[model samples]
Target: MTGTRTQVVVVGGGQAGLAAGYHLRRLGVDFVILDAQSTPGGAWQHGWDTLHLFSPAPYSSLPGRPMPHQPGQVYPDAAHVVAYLSDYEKRYELPVQRPVLVQGIHRDGPLLQVRTDSGTWSAHAVISATGTWWRPFVPAVPGRRLFEGRHLHTVTYRAPADFAGQRVIVVGGGNSGAQIAADLTGHADVTWATARPPRFLADDIDGRALFDTATARRRALDNGQADTAGVAALGDIVAVPPVRAARDAGLLNAVPMFTRLTAPGPQWPDGSITRTDAVIWCTGFRPALAHLAPLHLRDRHGRIATTGTRALDEPRLHLLGYGDWTGPASATLIGVGRPAREAAREIKAILGPGHRPQG
Candidate 1:
């Protein structure tokens, strides 16, 4: 396959990229997903070994396909997720070119040239679904660089056994911080630090409720009604088994962020410094848009501006799964499908009614 013939080129091959490919395939649009990884799992394949979807199987699935899970099980782990994504591509026969690292994209008169390590993919439209896992952001404290203790972002963290018998500070208020802190409890003395007080949802309320609330919020916004419901960022942390266990063990509590870093640990404003062996920064990620730098699609905040799934400036370029700017919960497995289908539809509409590529 060559760049001159393909109609759409989807980037990333993660859940967001897969969802977009599914919709484009249904339309018979000659498209291909460029995946940097050798295998089918997106960031999930690179996630922590114990990572599981916060939502249940029903809500965590892609469009048209229910993720295969144990009959009574609700959440599937990282390995299970990778298997499902691999099978999904085979089931739909989605055109995915893996082990291909896309370097950049540029406008070439009528077509967009997607330059990659293997070759350039010239297409009428390009959908970038490259997610945030590659770009983790850790806030800088005054004396952070002076600390000699070991430091790692969530991207490099995997097992708790490595930190056994040590005092660890897990930073960030999101689910990653909570889950990692919980995992470290038995192995290490853990202190959960957050920019603000960590909010925990009721034990029974899970991701199902979070998705429903997001849906309702989207509906209200679509209808132009002011509906401020749950927390702005999905409903707090889901009460996963591990998190619940941590709570029961009195390890789920969070403390205010430390003022600065000491040689061995973080120092509070009260002049008390707690000795910390390691710091696991579970801080969230920024949008990974380095490949699109030549396109100049980002703002000062390093965000690609989009109206729904469509680019605010370039009509043929679409960005999926970055965040709410693309669609409601656009980064999630379930949420990504809506923007994917919409982008495919818009591409077909722009290219005329009969632009079918040989499958």
Candidate 2:
């Protein structure tokens, strides 16, 4: 009963979207995948050059393909990862309709309507595999506009050479900040600002598995330390010092996260100021669901309500890659696959072949 329709529509073509597409194909489901980027790999292709996932190779690989590295080896680079995603797309022949930015998803009677630049399409079910980094988190630091130098967010960061010889301040203690600081320190004067000096972990430390910090943090959170210990202690965000250890080597200075960024630079708790030529905000990201206004679905924290591992409340709407607040695996490359596969299975089971209305 439609001019254009699919059994399932997957929004996003990153690792999560690709994984969902792969499993949907395996189950003999009819589906279409959509991505905003010209190609796949989502935001990975656009990240900083020195980036290798914090997770080891084994933990980062997708469902079927091997990562071409030893289990615990650090991944090659961003380009290599992007190439692999491209290969994944070709191997499975996932029907990814790309360069088609999805504007929104709304219900057209009983059918879910996906609005895109090309046209509107209807689907029995929809899987949104959009990653956690939907929107870059840039705070409104006062006097930021007064700064004369070129300011950029981590989203715009591509390589270290661009910031060479520049005085750069990285504002965050997460993995991204650490990695960027490590890379920039070799060529630029880099300063890292955080609320507290994080207890750093490495890919491996002292030849032993660096699992205790994460395990302890998780246990504490589960035991109701989520609120009491606060964001600094939870270690929800990765605080691993980069392999190069730029902070330890004095190439980068770790400053306490302070309040009020002045025209001169960041102000610390102890009446100190750090001057910088440029500031790269590694604050974090928030989901951009402004397009989902019609759905009227939200959680306590103003995020879209999702459960059953990204399975949405509406009969046809589902979510993927929403494990941001979950466990260690929630936001990792390999972590997204489970929810994606489950969404595909749920779509297939709910809308078996004959459910399609006659034209």
Of the candidates shown, which would achieve the greatest TM-score relative to the real structure?
1
After superposition, the stretches of candidate 2 with alpha carbons farther than 4 Å from their true spots are: 1-3, 70-73, 202-244, 310-312, 325-328, 353-359
Q: Which residue window of length 10 is worst by lDDT in model 2? A: 203-212
Q: Candidate 2 clashing pairs?
A: 194-257, 310-319
Candidate 2 local lDDT, 260-281, one digit each (tens): 7777777777878777788888
Which runs of model 1 end up more than 4 angstroms from their true locations? 1-4, 229-235, 356-359
Model 1 C-alpha lDDT per residue in residues 21-56, reported as the tens digit of each score:
999888878888999999999999888867888877
RMSD of each: 1.9, 4.2
